[model samples]
Target: MSQLVVEWDRLNHEIEEMTALVGKKDAEMALLKAQLAKAQTEGPGTEEVKELRVKNAALLS
Candidate 1:
């Protein structure tokens, strides 16, 4: 029926939007992981440590 077709189209559109959002989140997580790794390797200074703490808190929320 036409109503079913409309519902199917809406669900598909929602799924596509969610998929794109997930991709963006994946990229952000990768970048955050890379930054954490780099900071660990370089040995964080006081300011860097503070910054990292702020970032950690933000992530926890």
Candidate 2:
């Protein structure tokens, strides 16, 4: 019936909207994961930390 068709169309539209939102969130999550991996790989080994470690060792000695 026409009513059923209307309901089906509404459900399909909702599904499409939800699918697009999920896809956007997935892309955002992938970007965040990449940033996290980069940070983990490159973190805390800079000259500043090395200098701090040397100062701490001198103080302790």
Candidate 3:
């Protein structure tokens, strides 16, 4: 039916949008995780990981 077709089209559009958003979030999460790992390995005061060190020092202190 026409109504069914319309509903299917809407759902497909929504799925496409959701997929794009999920991909973006996944990329962001991957970048954050890499940064966190780098920070952990590089020591606390280096420019790339200064924030991580500060938080860890504060927690320990």
* Candidate that scores best on TM-score: 2
Clashes of each: 0, 0, 0
What is the C-alpha local distance difference test score of each model?
Answer: 0.96, 0.96, 0.91
lDDT of 1 by residue, 1-61 (tens): 9999999999999999999999999999999999999978898688988999999999999
lDDT per residue, candidate 3, 1-61, as tens digits?
A: 9999999999999999999999999999999999999978776556747777778999999
Cα-lDDT of candidate 2: 0.96
Cα misplacement distance, residue 54 of candidate 3 (Å): 17
Q: Which ten residues in a row have the lowest lDDT in candidate 1?
A: 39-48
lDDT of 2 by residue, 3-52 (tens): 99999999999999999999999999999999999997888768879999
Report the Cα lDDT for residue 10, model 3.
100
Between which residue pairs do clashes occur in model 2? none
Cα shift from native, residue 22, model 2 (Å)? 0.5
Q: Which of the two, 1 or 2, has more TM-score? A: 2
Question: How far is 6's C-alpha from truth in model 1 (Å)?
Answer: 0.3
